[model samples]
Target chain A: MREVAVVGVGMTLFGKHTETIRELGEEAVWAALQDAGMSPKDVQVAYAGNALGRISGQEMVSGQMVLREVGITGIPITRIEDACASASFAFRESWLAIASGLYDVAMAVGYEKMTGATTAQIMEALAGASDTELEADLGITFPGVFAMVARRHMYQYGTTREQIAYVSVKNHDNGALNPRSQYQKRFSIEEVLASRPIASPLNLLDCCPISDGCAAAVLVAKDLAPRYTRKPVWVAASGQASGFFEPGSDVTVLKPTIAASQSAYKQAGLGPEDIDLAEVHDCFTIAEVLHTEDLGFAPKGEGGPFIMDGNTAIGGRIPINTSGGLLSKGHPVGATGLAQIVEIVEQLRGQSGHRQVQGARAGLAMCLGGFMHSDAGVVAVHILKA
Target chain B: MPETESTENSRIINEKWFTETPQGKALAGSRCRKCGRTYFPRKRVCVQCFEDGRMEDVALSRMGRLYTFTVAEAGPPGFTLPYAFGYVDLPEGVRVFSPLGGDFARLEIGAEMEMAIGPIRQDDGVDVIGYIFKPV
Candidate 1:
């Protein structure tokens, strides 16, 4: 396959919005095109990631909506939805398309307007990705499932409730530096631990808030690099895996993430030890710790202790979630994956003014999606280099 | 009177109550003849094996382990909160998601459980009889 490099990445601030989903995509795409030193006309093919638009009475094709606005049409545009990893998969697809010589330049963007949906509608849509008979039938919501995992970790690892709140606290610390973060207000551990419980043992702060946002990226061949930007972050490797979807399998750990990450590491010719920084899918506080362990950044069951060591801060051994991750970055499902790419791009490009990881070389981005029946629908990992 | 059907694959679809035979008497399940896979609520076609006909009837074990569980403090508006929910991994190699009855303190893994079905919940003003596990 031909080598692909990310020429530019862009995203909108995460929060409530009056703009339509198409507008969100348009905003990000416009910024990304400007960053790539090109317009919508430069994109030969496009892919957009969106989880729900029809529920709000806007169905049809998503590609046409945004592309039509940008005055670029008649080219291939597809919407991909793999839950939270929706945008990352789109990024992976764009990279492959360019790398395979099928397209010299490609654009991938993810947008989600989740706050528009009512609470019940949101729950049903989220549950639609789960096992119908096993989970949906019993009205088991996503928070309930995540709470199960958090509770299991708490029981097995003796992880206290306060430590769990610290995850949000740490993420918010980074969020405070991030103007784009949703919850920029810093919270204390006691405040988080005292928050009302959404599910048993899972306080409100333990869960990432539903958010609205969009993120986009432009990928092209390394040979065509300097044409778009002077310094392009090289796409070293990409890997993805799916696991069995049954509660019979254990939820204490993520098997798909481990497998996907290993494959990515093998392809990149680098191990987890070489990663200077990372952006993990912390849809929940526990998810960050689990992903850290599953990605081999830490040993088994040592993730809690590893985070407690303060090694994931800006100056730590491997600063993580410099963009505040889903916890503070706001998990607008479709937008989350691409947002991770944007954060890593910003960090690698040395553009992260305050939250930048000094001398960051190679970085890893892990995206996990569709936790159903104890199985993660897809786990995608990408290694980027400066 | 003896039912006289020992084919290990025959059962009436309308049999609301479970049939208890002399030798084997527990909860009966349907087995897909093509793949030999079993399911608690018998169906015409097995989700697996992709084969629809010639499914056999069998009995499931009376006990299972509490795979993973939680006390859901908040659920749907109509549904009551603070209910114990979990999946029971049966000895028959099938995992069943159900509610735990009696006491939450005693809900432990590898606990013996028997199915108790009743109007455990109400939805849209309709009574729904669901299954729950009781420590046996």
Candidate 2:
């Protein structure tokens, strides 16, 4: 395969959206095309990632509808739905299209409208990602699912409630600097600990909010990169993996993440130590801790203390979730992975302003999708370099 | 007689999953004749050794240990809140996801549990008989 680079990236402020899903996609697509010094016509192929479009009343073939809204139709447009990692998969596919010489320029867009639906409606829609026949039948919500994982981690590694709370504190602090973050206010550890309980050991503060947003990226062949911009974030590696069904599998270890990260590191020829920063799928506070260990950023079971000591904060040794992650940036589900990519590209280009990691040359963005039975449905990892 | 009647009359969540045996009500799983590997909610073929895994129906161990649990303080509409949901590791080497009943405060990891079938929720005045794990 040939080399590919992310020429431009764009994302809307991750919060509630009053407009339709197609409108959201249009705005992000326009912004990305403009940033790339190209137009909608320049995009040869497109991929859209939307998880709950049907539940939002957006019918199937939503990709074609959204593309038509942007005045780009009749191209080979395919929709992807992989729970939370939907956009990451789209990005991977976009990278493949460009790397395989199939398309010189491709666009990947992820959008979701979560706030337009009622709380109960949104919960039920998200529940579709789980094993509806088994787990959801037990009335287990998302927080309930992660709480069990947290409980297991606590039982196995002596991880404390306060330790997990520290992750929220750190991410919220970073979110305070990020204008695009949903919650910009910083919360103290005491405040997080005292928040309303969603599940035992995990309060409302530990969970990412249901959000509505859109993110887009423009990928091009490596040789054509300089024509679009001065600095391009090269797509060094892309890896995706599926986990085994949860039954009889270990919960504490995110096996898909472990496998995907190994593949990404191998493809990139870089290890955890070489990463300057990272954007991880912190759907919950405990998730960040587990991912840190699974991605080889910390020793097995040492992720709890790693954050408690302020190691993951900005200016620390290998800062993580510098854009505040899904916890504060808000998890728009389908749009989350591409949003993480947008941040990494911005950080690498030194355009992140206050949230920037100084002199960052390489970054990793990881997204975990869906829960099947007990394990994750899918995981996608992307490594980017300047 | 009541248990057998409920299994026949009431709508159990995923009927193919649970079966009432002479011993008692247990998860209806399938064991591979070739590899001896077992799967809950019975599969048509073995995933591992694919040797025409024509699985034979077998009852899973009713007793198991609570691997982990959580008390959910919130839930979707039409569902009971503040319920106990968890994973139970049966002796058959398969873990099952179910809602737990009995003392929530006393629930501990690795605690012994046994299978129990009862009403999980009421839909339109009809009780939905479902599988659950209760403290042994």
TM-score of each: 0.89, 0.97
Using TM-score as the measure, which candidate wins? 2
Question: Which is the leading candidate under DockQ?
Answer: 2
Best candidate, lDDT: 2
Give the per-residue lDDT of model 1 (tens digit) for B1-136. 2232222332222243244656533556787888777776566787776787878877777678777677766565445767677777887667776767768878766677777644445555554545567877
By DockQ thresholds, what CAPRI class is model 1?
acceptable
**What DockQ do the predictions score, one after another?**
0.36, 0.75
Task: Write model 2 residue lDDT over A239-327, tens digit each, in one string.
Answer: 99998774577788989999999999999999999999999999999999999999998997899999899889999998999999999
Give residue A252's lDDT in candidate 2 (0 to 100).
85
CA lDDT, candidate 1, residue A282: 85
Per-residue lDDT of candidate 2, residues B9-91 (tens digit): 46666677778788777899998888888888888878788867478999999999999899888776656777788999988
Given candidate 2, what's the lDDT at residue A287? 95
lDDT per residue as tens, model 1, A227-314: 8899899999999999765436778788999889999999999999999999998887888878888898888777777787888878
Task: Write out the backbone clash pairs for model 2.
Answer: none
